[model samples]
Target: MRPMLLATASVAVLTLVALSAPVRAADAPFNRISTFNVVENLPAGADPAKPTAAEIITYTEDGNTLIYSDSPGERIGFIDITDPAAPKAAGVVALDGEPTTTVVIGSKAYVGVNTSVSKDKPSGHLAVVDLATRKVEDKIDLGGQPDSIIKSPDGSYLAIAIENERDEEVNDGALPQLPAGNLTTFEVKDGRVVDASKKVIDLTGLAAIAPEDPEPEYVDINSRNEVVVTLQENNHIVVVDLPTGKILSHFSAGTVDLDKIDTKKDGVIDLSGSMKAVPREPDTVQWIDDNRFVIANEGDWKGGTRGFSIFDKTGKLLFESGTAPEHMAVRLGHYPEKRNKKGIEMEGAEVATFGDDRLIFVASERGSLVFVYRDKGPGAAPEFLQVLPGGVGPEGLMALPKRDLFVTAAETDNRKDGGIGSVVTVYQRQPGATAAYPTLLSVDGPDGLPIWWSALSGFAADAKDAGKLYAVTDSAYAQARILTIDATATPAKITAATVVTRDGEPAKGLDLEGIAVRPEGGFWVASEGNPEKKEKPTQNLLLRVGADGAIAEEIALPEAVAAQAGRFGFEGVAVVGTGADETVWIAVQREWKDDPKGFTKLLAYKPADKSWGVVRYPLDKAAKGWVGLSEVSPYKDGLIVIERDNQIGNDAVIKKLAYVSLKDVKPAPLGSEVTPPVLVKSEVKDLLPLLKATHGYVLDKVESFAIDAAGNAFIVTDNDGVDGTSGETQFMSLGKMN
Candidate 1:
């Protein structure tokens, strides 16, 4: 295992400077700008007072247009910016179910539609549309409400994020309602639907260590083929294996107990005989390599202390940067001249690396700055470089070989125009300088507004070629676009890109989450449906895009077997292929239902015939009731799905090593269990309760899960921490399931 790097005196100096800068206003000028707004408002009869559900916004690789959707509108919109200065409304597509999210591959776009418009229904669907034609080519009926959609790097599998809240209400009668969600896997072949499976590994055991309060939030797969998930509310990281969908390990990233903290001192307080720690919110996770990951430790949902924590691929305890890891400076004292109050000191690193001599980058989201550092050794303090300021909200950071550059999506309320988000900023390393600040370049959108608000998520570069860069944004539009950057370009502008629009119409009702590039010039994007609109849910859609910004093809999802009576969707995407051709893998999350035997779905797709297939594995039996599938990625010869068991009163478990063959895959037996061996069991544990009592019962629930390359899985809890009793927070793991 690699050693953790500590902060040095130089870091202290930088921290002081970071604490002195003022917060940038939302309307600050950027190099290049673009924006998109939901052109259409809520329907005439819709509730005007309700907050517009549309949140995420994203772009395609060709960078020509933008795609987004919204829950309140229950529709998807497309904006064509073949001209960055002026963007035109391409078109908007309506769906039978409430559309939540979308992902575009080639010519096909997959959308996660929520059919359960009310708490009584709680189901959804996945809509497959042809981008070139702008028509709903196919629709998969997912039994439960879905969350997010993802594809495997090989192009053989599809993963869905499923929520099964109804099961918890039914099984644990009269108990406090636990948010039920899991990860599902599906099989696809040549744009057709195929086999599907679900794994809901038990997590009842972890309850002893950390309380279950919030449900899972985000899930992903790392290079090592492991699944990692973030339990937002609970502040724990769950790790699982891919093939078997088993819980390999679990660890707490950070713990906080507001009740025990002295409001006057901002520190934990000791009770007569017990110690109380404040709860922290673990928002995001990024893999540095196959065996290492960096976690964004948002101290508390109330916006208290914030920092970053580093962990090995196995979820082991590593090093953590102090509070407020971003590069923004906080005011030291009250200023009489400005009549302003003093601000808290900012410290810690936002993101860090562990390869080729450790390094860390502290990104100040509000300040639009970054602080660089060189790690001396494991647990040894890192040496600070200099304070570098540029684009806004440098949330996502990517380090290229020899040369390191970070991408900033200048996402802010001011950058948004008529609901459309704008451009991405590129900060390149300056040549012949070790401490000089990187040069900033703007990757503009069609309307010249910053193409980012809260939508941008991940960034990837071709391993063989350093000149190519790909970034993804989550949008309400049916499709998520990829921004392809030419690293060789002097100013680093996006030259070309593809979007998730069809027949000049945008795929409405889809929430796109993550994207990955394939070796064959084709890339994949993940779509997650909206849980709030579950009555008429949508199926998970996987799209494939060729090198020239053209849609190559798309795969339609099949109905989930565990979905019994509701709808389903997907969240994350990953692909793994050999030779000239590759197989695509997708993760599916089944919607929550009232049934006790509910399960999630996972599927695979092949590009050869554009047909769909399923993994003939018995994952449902392993989960033993309703299971929520979160994420899936390529591992060994098969793929892995993060199976989160959401059954009430049961501890969540990480299921691993559930393997399936790529050849001769078929669709799942809807509402039936056929294949048996695919169901593999992993470490099971009860999740710690967020509060000792929520009214009368404890709060515990699993939300999202993901795995890294070395089989390390991270689980994110969804404990809101609103209650005072629950103190369990973040968790992680670095060991394999026995």
Candidate 2:
């Protein structure tokens, strides 16, 4: 196979940095333990359709309970994590307004509530709630829309960032349209707030940009009662003494030159793109120690540099992550191509000391991942640890070092779009457990960039190699390509990629979903089609591809058979027999317009005669959504098929492997008026247990399955290219099928 040259010098440098990343062999790895859906705690009788989100999260002082602010529901939610692995719904405290951030002190929870009627009239308050009773005990007027709230390490002071946020629709989201946000602080006596000690410190004229409207976005407190705040829109950082409300130091958050990033939203991840002097408008800041802190350059208004940075109290740049984390996302198939302007959009940061190591976690909102790093003290580069799958759009990161657990609140609830709901995922630091994720990963190509791949819909095992497989990408990406996977690796690695080409150019309008190695040589790939699509309508096609990835032939269905096709078409393809008896099999997802009420067709194409035949396949009765076929592979004297329901998460039910015998059975010719013979099938394995093993919400797309020469079977799921899904691909081995 030839290496695709998609890397520039800058990209190669970034890739090299990732290739040589520090590895701490003795350190324990964090693995996901459980997942909790916020909807499970929804108030009784409340409309379930109303969108709810877990934006900011914090744990109790004892680290046995979790409190998260739900902005859409106008409430604060609590989860009892006494068992860590089995979190329960503790209840919720309803606030009259949107809850921005929450922090717990002793038995009480301090919540920043935004009651703003408009962007210009930013009004909010602090709601102190009794955690045991789940009741609001007190409310103190904050005088503006509050964003981030934190407490000093000694619990003597509380600092709130009064973000009089700007109205983006007014002037292209430019700054300087505010009531001028300030830092509001108060002295803490015992476990209560001293209302008389409320102090509003003016933060104006501190930043070089948008000095008049300084909207502080996030805040963190140090051991010395010093507060560090980030003015996200202004691209500035400020440090203040909590005891005297005096400005300690302040400086611009600054800009960086970025390379090897996908900057265009053009349905492709081209790492050769570059940008100069991109603003690092840091969003979340957390102090790693008294003199240093880390910032997530989320870049809300103008720039999102796609990485994080560490800075000292005097605003000195300690470390810049550059494009390393972004490149990691590409390697793991977590890159969000639609959000190219921000490129993974690093948005959340958390720092804590676990055992002997101070760990810094940086989260990517678009990538649905969290990059872990071991802090190496002040002004030093932190050692990169393994990254974690933080669900979809992870917004809140909280580390409980004492409990050896980490939590992330994913804000995206894509249930309406047939995706999963908002979830709070828990992970534990196991001493010697290998990372359970990235079950499949892509290695760097000869060009130095990772062989970026995702949306795996079908698989074909190598005829000679037991641990080798070939996978196909669906329509999630523009250019269709075939990836080679070495299934023997701990986490199956994609060793190479071959782009399916036509006339020396990457093929277009092809949603390649199935692949099968031809008995003679080359491959036979099935491209799923949708006739209802108004733009560039496609037809289901079976292509004969050469060993070099070039198209040798394009075979379409007969006109009579093609006319009956609907949105769903060929989902999987396989080959059986050799030479004169060679035949290609295709699994049609869902039912065509002419299919019977509870059955779809299994297509048989004879390569020798170029004739088509079909046998009806029975679909399981779905209790909720529609049932469909995902994959079909030839096994023994029969074929194994993956049948599943369209429901995701807790609602999923029918994800299974079934065997259908084909001995002595004949398929009717295409467009036959008589009823086709129904193949008898027996259940092979229930896939629910394997799908739930990773401890994440059950994914809906269980699309690929294949059995190798050694009879080893494997199953893989398509992430929809991280579109609405969590970008988590579960590539697991089902051991031997025979």
Candidate 3:
């Protein structure tokens, strides 16, 4: 089992410990942060099989570890690491069948277990584990397979990801099995689990799935109590209501085509021939405010222009950053080479916000650096900022509020060094912050073989105080776990860390992808699904700890919906508010087949409303099935969904603008008017002349959408073109219906 390497980096030259770091203060630029590598491997008793599978790892508030099952390994690993730097082997646990993922609440941990890896028998079970005792406390046997899990913020209800299968025995005419995904809610009181309500969210009924493509990833929840999900095979994002489980709206975040860029443009580049936009990957989503979010685009296979899309609450298109726009500046050559100060530009910029200001900070993975820009303020033309060196393949970023610190995850290129990884650089802001420049205190990683093989996936911070930082990795072995460090701790030392597996057992799987922090403490982890399974589904796990730094509770998913035929999974998680009465929103990806009536589903859970049950909503229904649905965000009283549409025959397109309201979602008001079609007729000669004089296809792929409190929507298109030649992105007003 070659360990996968995850790396995250940043650049800063100064340090400020106070909450206020001089908003937009200008100062002289300083050198990038220094780098270091802290290597820690699993104990000798850990699995030695060298499994060729990926592992997902996460950390809890009390400092316990939560691990999910991944391919090549079909179990969950739980390790104790009250100490962030040194992790102790706790124990490994597995289900009677293949497990999807796990989530924790209070003192219980919920685990989704799939019984059959093959299509023959797709039944599964939801296993409940006691984190305090480190044992499988109970189990809920369910039909089909359970993909993912979600719990309300108040810990009242639990939602399970379920794929429904057709009643073949009753329909007996040799019809193909109609596989769909749905949500099942379980009530929680006094730490005990009880069944509540169940709703079948049928994706196949919404649209047809592309023949060769897989189902969408999972549905995500936003700040406004909305569910956002994607139609993977098709390129689209679906938005829904969390409280009522209703379908509100859907949109397309444009896709990208790497081949579209014409490096040798003898003439103007034509994107039509090269590539099409696809859906956003379910792995990346960041919350800007209660009503807005930014999504990351994977770009086309050929690697084209990729960036993020912004949207308002109510599923409307706002605006997107320019296509393949240069957001960072870098100095070439080695240090001391004064003449090498020239800068090079990078493509596909992803952004995150620090405060309530219009300036949004961006991280360019391809550029291997970070940049700052005015995302919404007046005359906001993104300006260049200091660049963090090394830390290639940056993905997700977390901002430390009071300490003025920022951390990012680095997904290392595995082909280079057998997939070993390292942490990216971390930087702190100084008091003398300015518009032209800013000071930073930096920390870098080691430069070697085994040290740079790991890749960082998700990030989170301590809610009460931003001084504690936590990050996870997407590695299989190499003790894939969560590392905890003090935000104000100088020299960037790993204070504590925890791995999923223990006792040298390979049954405990840990391929963690996304993570979020709760106000009370602890962390939530999402699994991307096992690569080995043809029907890849995702899962969620909750990890909680106490002030004593002990594993207080591990709440595994309770039983509700069973997995069936289609692929149902989860990606992102967010806690909308504070206090014990808060709500928890989870993202799920529901798959559809070639059937024209396929659709994607998103779900929400309110732990406080234990009896009210879990609510689900439909984002979009396609005549054709969608491929990958990645992320969701809450905006005002609604939600924004980011989806990647992978249609067959045509190039993939990304969907950006879409909305869903939480107030009142009644069966999508019947009798909605359909626009009349237009017809055009012209002579062949005239048509040829018009074609030669026109730009490529007017409609591009859209992947993700975000919304602000004022109802302004922002759409992002994945222009998968290189060298600014082929792909192009557009910014449009949502209300302008042409």
Candidate 4:
């Protein structure tokens, strides 16, 4: 007899095996397994230039098919999830209007289509799509714009949040901006809606503040035929008995006093700010049980408490995780610094019972992260299991307990913005599987708070400690800082941080891209320059800084070569020896005006004598975009460089580790007209496979490369500080490089 995975086996077969015995939840926790890009559904003749998104998602009765709302594409797309690890595109059902949410009942998908001509003239409908036919069979008028839709536990009713959302321009997003919103409901049987049973429930004058404008945001129901709705703009929660269409009880979602949070866009993650009495303008809510529920405080319109809360049936606060999620994000270097006003922006929540455990999943839109916790029950708080990187701006989540699967629908479409587009990421729970994300993180600082950091652009292993390493941030931060990482930790922790200072004040406007420890107790850093900025043209520099962060020296390109330097300057720096005999090598990202076509330079500098020399490095022919060098590091008898294409996502082609032996290599003088010999290169490894292993879009910047003290090679990608990118950083170690 074979004891096995049993993934595709029948339940009866599993029941027969379970009679022998089964393991506990301790074996398999939730972990991401795959990512599906929505662009694969771009229809025939459709402009590939346009964007598409996967907002709210739902699965079929058998959990083999996944349906998601695509607002930009004006359709509902499907995915074949028969094998959760390798999902395939199953086509799309075009809609007449923007899709807000999709819910599957039997073989039919009920999608809320927002047909609003304008905010003041709100209009929409519920389109019932026949999944097999791939067509919309019926449309039920919703009367107003709908945001979220939920079906009763017994499949007896469908509840919709008729959010006639207010225009923010009119009153700075204040409520009572009139044309108040409400709730709509209808009877459902066997997966088809009974149109005649529609009910428009009035939900006004329910909150103490802005009682006239009840902008319903999200809805969910209990097993007892009771529905809970969040009036986001008014900062209130209301429960209605679906059968009677009557408001049972209502109360304010309330405020919270927060501390140890970064409240400004200062480009640094210092947890010393505070928000007092900030209203919890919840966006998504889910019921854990008939008597308990959870709300994600998205802080739309006015308030965002920066966390999620659990409450009882009568609106009593059961648990408040104030600033806790944001703190956890800080610990993982996933905090979006520019979005400090609403740290992490908890926007989606899902609760499901898997095996003997009940799990609550909370998602952060701005942070692109999801926090998973195991519910301990009514009186106690949930236990944190792990944090998952859901694509960019994850707006909704679905938990399939029967299939042991959890899915996230990220609504961001950044193709037009030169970023990763919307994607539906798949995660599965299996015993003995390890959490795959956040390969590295930071520990608490002196204030007993997590060391907040992001936009890591460079990496170098500690010459002594096996798992200890150093990193630097890019221009995304105003103050140039160096962070120390302890990669030995399960999630690799950042033990400390130091701000790079020049003379006295923090180094300003530095686009630091590379760093190498100087063996003599300090470091040499490379700062990429931007010559086009209006303020002042910054020159690429090789800077030597003391162990305490004070600048010791700054070496610029020789005058003649500096005059012809383009925007793509030095990206990486590596030093080969000690003080007097040290030869510093700087890698130019791309060819400058003075260089040969399709070739970049490996410039050399001898600090012992202030001499400059340059050698050419062949560039790979990019299939679709420009290719350039990302990093330079001494490895064994030669130097290893990370060469990559500028394209992201599906357009990415080349991400390679190439090496150049230094045996007979000699750099030509910087301004010499004589052509220098280009180095003969050999492939060390193809980083493309490793980059795609994260189950995300192939990140464009494979910037940092280093071989640790234990001879293990490591690579880190730059997230562009979450600017236009998905804010997903990949830091992994490739064990033992020969």
lDDT of 3: 0.39
- Scanning candidate 1 in windows of ten residues, the lowest lDDT window is 332-341
lDDT of 1 at 42: 36
Question: Per-residue alpha-carbon lDDT of model 3 for 227-305, expressed as tens digits?
Answer: 5544433334455565676766654444432322223222212122233443333223333455554444443222323
Question: If both were scored by lDDT, which would come out higher, candidate 2 or candidate 4?
Answer: 2
- Per-model TM-score, in order, reads 0.41, 0.97, 0.40, 0.95
Given candidate 1, what's the lDDT at residue 218?
45
Cα lDDT tens digits, model 4, 599-637, are: 999988888899998899999998986889989999876
lDDT of 1 by residue, 145-225 (tens): 665555544454555655433333454432123444455556556754453443444443342222433244445566545
Off by over 4 Å in 2: 1-26
Better of 1 and 4 by TM-score: 4
CA error at residue 280 for candidate 1, angstroms? 2.9
lDDT of 2 by residue, 422-502 (tens): 999999998887877778888888888877887899999989999899999989998899999999987889999999999
lDDT agreement with native, every candidate: 0.44, 0.89, 0.39, 0.85
How accurate locally is residue 479 in candidate 3, as Cα lDDT from 0 to 100?
38
lDDT of 2: 0.89
